[model samples]
Target: MRFYPATLSRLLAVAALAFSPLSWAEQAISDGVYEIHYNAFNSSFITPEVAQQNGLMRSKYRALVNVSVLKLQDDGSKQAVTAIVSGQAANLIGQAQQLEFKKIDEGKALYYIGGFRFTEDEQLKISLSVQPDPNKPAYNIEFDQRFYVD
Candidate 1:
């Protein structure tokens, strides 16, 4: 998991000791210079303290989306960079909900997270727009995710 924030690991954890299918599945994308990593999972797995401190909704029906941007340097090292990330999630039935992102800043490391509601066994199509830098073109990515409520 390529998380920028120090407390992100504590926030995004698998429900069980094993790697369940519904675990945090982080994915990455790049346009040569910029790398964007993102993932979405049920918010209930996060501890109450972590959730409260981060203003995350910790309910079975709530889900959170995490996104981080990195810039590739000439030395082949990735540097965390701030970016504007916004998106929306739409269910299979075409019900769309806008995602309001909250920036979590941790010194040099920072990331954007958004929360949305989901139903049991609900599958949603997530669409995101990432702009790591104004000089570069904006990145758009989409994926489908299924959420289960315990």
Candidate 2:
């Protein structure tokens, strides 16, 4: 069987894509802090009509935040932290801090986390602790919103 140069190139490209790191989801975690996992998607939220109506003369930007805490080890130790998944959307520019948390309906001590329109270049601070009972620590998480313009 003889393969043309174009056919061989196509096969190589497919193999490269299959083995590329970009083809897999990326996950990163900051020890004793939080974990984030995400995959790039199509960026097509900006429309000419929206730019004209909303007075946005530049390209639009969007990002997803998936953060959470793993376990609760000790008193004053932040744990069980999770990012609030809200439907709130905002421009990557400007100043805004929108975050909310609620107790989880299931599990021994679980909670639901969510946030909206977080626009900042500072690291978000999440503090968890047990007030009266050091054994039962709560979670408080902060998210530093960062943006990358192209």
Candidate 3:
């Protein structure tokens, strides 16, 4: 079998440049400012007076999150913020331009805060609630920081 049309058009241009999608879209995720970490857990450890004495309206959880982007390289060295974690919710996590909280310090168990800047890239929907009898969860946790300018 002799087939030659410039060798079948060079084997179909090397199989269309090896099945290109622009070579995997240049590893996506670009358009910076990202620093997000969220955690939610209730693997049947339900304790809100035992989930309202077993009347449990709704309680089931497991959410672990992390997203980082703090690459400041001009002199003041700081380059350790390259993250990705999902239980869902993270197209860019709050899309940051600014989300200041820079420091709260105090951790032996858990309380070490510093959250700021989230230059948007879209896809960040978060909703969490837990309250029962003067325990906690009155409402105070909101974030929506999206930025993409130059």
Candidate 4:
């Protein structure tokens, strides 16, 4: 499906999550009709204005996980879909913290963001349960990433 330029613009405006240390690709899980995109990065990369606007704390020890769900239309366009998402992040030391997601609905561009704490050079396993439709089962997502304080 075609991910519109406007959608990216809005997502960046709201989340500003694309700014990472250098480069980090957003991973996607697809089930033909639906696609879930997610990623995690240090929140300090976020601009101060945007972080405050979103009521988020920017710190070296803090990170953010971003999730977005979309549906593929017949026209090859991607339409943002509302979803039920819950998750948690666990460090290698078995320290698990529940991720409380806050939905950012921009009408056509929707996303869920969760914040967590970590130390320098710490690795975290993030798992999320995403249900794009109440009638369907939730998609289980798990991934690992290392965060740095720099």
Candidate 5:
């Protein structure tokens, strides 16, 4: 399948807005210098065509988590920061799954994304560790997310 850059750009723009920290009161967290935003959505949101074009696995039982980190500049402007990101998801039954994150760089935009499979209406506790830079300390994050297949 041939994926149009313009289409992909549009999709990403929409996703960025949907996942922006500003849109959610508690979705974003800060560590004095950096702000991290993380969220998960059902894979069904991405159509099979888009998934195939983007090299993503599309399945109703899968969920995708998107993470974005930004540095707070002196002038108040935010800049995208490169980070080594990884996480794990676990459910009440003690079933655990490790997330395999993929880094994506698009000009000034940088972020990490990972996918995991789960049963419908399953709730997961996600723990993510991010190292913003080689010299910077890693930040640990935890959040609860629920996925529903539609």
Candidate 6:
């Protein structure tokens, strides 16, 4: 099972995982050269076989976070770019959780996947910092989402 962020996004969307379209309204941060798409949803949306093949724990109580970086080419196309990503999730009650992302690189596509457990009615604020390369500046992104196991 190849862990492509776009592929996972489409699968999660079909499974009612609350995935937003790839528009500007979604959690996208761009630095004129690179754009990052951030997606998080309930892990129950993924099939057990796919989850197992991708090294993800298949549980309704788990949330999967994915990030993809794209570099805009001069010829009007987007290219997947690799980056170092790190982030954390926190609740309103001061409960903090760190995100340990596993990087996957397939050809020109790169993605970071991470999982965390959450309660049925809790909201988590996620923050991520991505550095595309040694010469580029880091991009910091912040967003809030609530996960429900039921």
Measured by TM-score, how close is model 1 to the native structure? 0.85
- Measured on C-alpha atoms, candidate 1 has an lDDT of 0.79
Best by lDDT: 4
Give the Å shift of residue 28 in candidate 4: 0.4
Count of steric clashes across candidates, in order:
0, 10, 12, 0, 0, 0
The lDDT values for all models are 0.79, 0.32, 0.27, 0.80, 0.76, 0.77
What TM-score, computed on C-alpha atoms, does each candidate reach? Answer: 0.85, 0.27, 0.18, 0.84, 0.83, 0.84
Q: Which pairs of residues collide in model 4?
A: none
- Candidate 6 on 43-120: residue-level lDDT in tens? 887877667766887787888788889998999789998888888989998787899888766566777888888998
RMSD of 6: 3.3
Q: 21-139 in candidate 2: lDDT tens per residue? A: 34343333444434332222111232344224323233323322222334445564544434433322334343344434333322332333333322233222322221223344433
What local lDDT does model 1 show for residue 15? 35
lDDT of 1 by residue, 1-150 (tens): 334366665455343222235344547788778889877877787778777777878898988888888899999998889998899999998999999999987776667889899998988999999998777767998988888895
What's the C-alpha lDDT at position 42 in model 6? 78
Kindly report which residue stretches of model 3 are placed more than 4 angstroms away from their true locations once superposed. 1-28, 32-60, 75-150
> Which residues of candidate 2, in runs, are more than 4 Å off?
1-24, 28-67, 72-90, 108-111, 117-150
Candidate 3 lDDT tens digits, 46-146: 23442243233222322111122334456755454422221223234333222212221112111111222222233344332111113422222333222
Task: Please report the candidate that would top TM-score against the real structure.
Answer: 1
Q: Better model by TM-score, 2 or 6?
A: 6
